[model samples]
Target: MQRSKVILNSPKIAIGSRADKYWSENGFLDYSKFIRPNLDLPKSLSYGSNPDLLRTKFGIAEIGFGNWVTNEDRFNYVNGLIISLYDLNKLMNIDYFLGLGLLSVSFGARGAGSALAHYESQTKIINVTRYHRGDESKLARFVATGGMGSFAHEYGHFLDYVGGEYVSPHPQVFALTGGRSVSRSRMPCNDRQRLRVITNDLLEKIIWKVPNKTPSAYYTRLAKFMMANGIESDYLIRRNELFARWFEAWVSLKLRSMNIQNKLLSQAKYSPLIYPTENEVREVDKIFQDFMKEFKSGYFIG
Candidate 1:
């Protein structure tokens, strides 16, 4: 099987602050280093920007920028973006298709240093303010590990887009979010719509079952902040967001359990933050394992 290629790009932009300067110098390089290894992608996966070589259908371009504009001079805060290759259904074989085929993951200098997922474009964005300006070594671990989780979550969306599903063997596990099955093709339009679809029973289950533990004060504070902002509810009730967040947490735990460097435990001091219980972890692990079996056999080729 041929490997998918990724092209990295950073456009020239004016740096407005010391933080932006830090990112301009080291963010993308460090991000590439941190994210690539943890993906556990098949060795066949590669990265490059050469149009001649990436003309193949399997190529993926990763365009990174510091900022994006909503209108004239109005900057929209974004961390990363993943534009689906299939969105260009008409021109799959053309260069225009290849351009949209790229996943645009950006790191914003502004905004709270948090990971975000966007459904419309199938993108994952992370704000890097904390990682670059704060404690570099410590925050790098947080950003890298947390970013990997976000990447996995967003990639889960990609999988759903490509005809894959995120499922568990037990049907009872899904009693809260409608049923045992959901698909990207059939997801609700937005998080608010999703809230209406989820059962109160499921919501209660999450309130009871999902633990609020974290490894460090930072994670604890972050969790509190997100909950206060209603982000946690969005993760719990929305089917797609729920699956992606689970994937994020499960992948983070797996990386830590494996004891790999700069994996999850790179922030060992903040270990166990925002983590699910051991039993819950095992359940999600099985789901991920099952998905990978199908994914490797069907979609991914070596």
Candidate 2:
């Protein structure tokens, strides 16, 4: 589907009897008792969708509570959510797979003044919320900055499911090993070996070389952090969570670069922003391009 049409089908906010029942029964915050639907649901968000190679469709719904809330707040929250999602779509051309369905966002006590977000594969839902203890303004900023990033991170999980496995290193591995069978005992031995080679090359050529870091410290730190935090192992051994984390970092850096002069980073509540050097962006772009090329070739199914 076209990106414009996809945004047209983006989720809408609702707070009447229907929303109340859905949240309460699902164990979400019980705002049904105190909150009532007061504002008109926004037909279109302020942000514009930028489509890339992937043409999947997704949606976002903002749920709010309390008497102090206004239509403006709802619009701001929804706009922020769309902006984040749009950035991801632009970066990864995420529309390639079945789009994320009904991403829900809200503000409430349940989140405990922090951002909570998750992607459910079974339901195909990405839910995000901002919790505030005292200041609603702070909460707004949180949702706009870190909260949006959190939503992108959750969507990254969906992307991982759709695109991660498809972009295997089997071709690269076979090329490196001169078309030998290598070992099918583990089923993904070639893929694993290829990843190891790429990672080591990235580490030695780009990550380890501090002054010569082609990608910049952001990717280097991310690679090191992933290794230190067990993501590399997960990516290699289990093939899960790594792509989501990478997606998160990629979205964060891209947004940060665009907003370098703004105070967005200073006000972020979680996941400090990282700036990628020009060379870093170039390298990462090449990585993603190669992956997408493989994905287009239908390698995973083969």
Cα lDDT for residue 266, candidate 2: 17
Please, what are the lDDT tens digits per residue for candidate 1 over residues 84-191?
222222112233232324443333332432543232233322222222334566435434433323444554444443322222122233222333243222323233
- Tell me, by lDDT, which candidate is best: 2
- Worst window of 10 by summed lDDT in candidate 2: 32-41
The C-alpha lDDT values of all candidates are: 0.35, 0.39
lDDT of 2 at 211: 35
Off by over 4 Å in 2: 1-73, 94-115, 136-146, 164-241, 255-283, 293-302
**Taking the tens digit of each residue's C-alpha lDDT, what string does model 2 give over 225-259?**
65776563332222233344444555556655654
TM-scores of all models?
0.42, 0.45
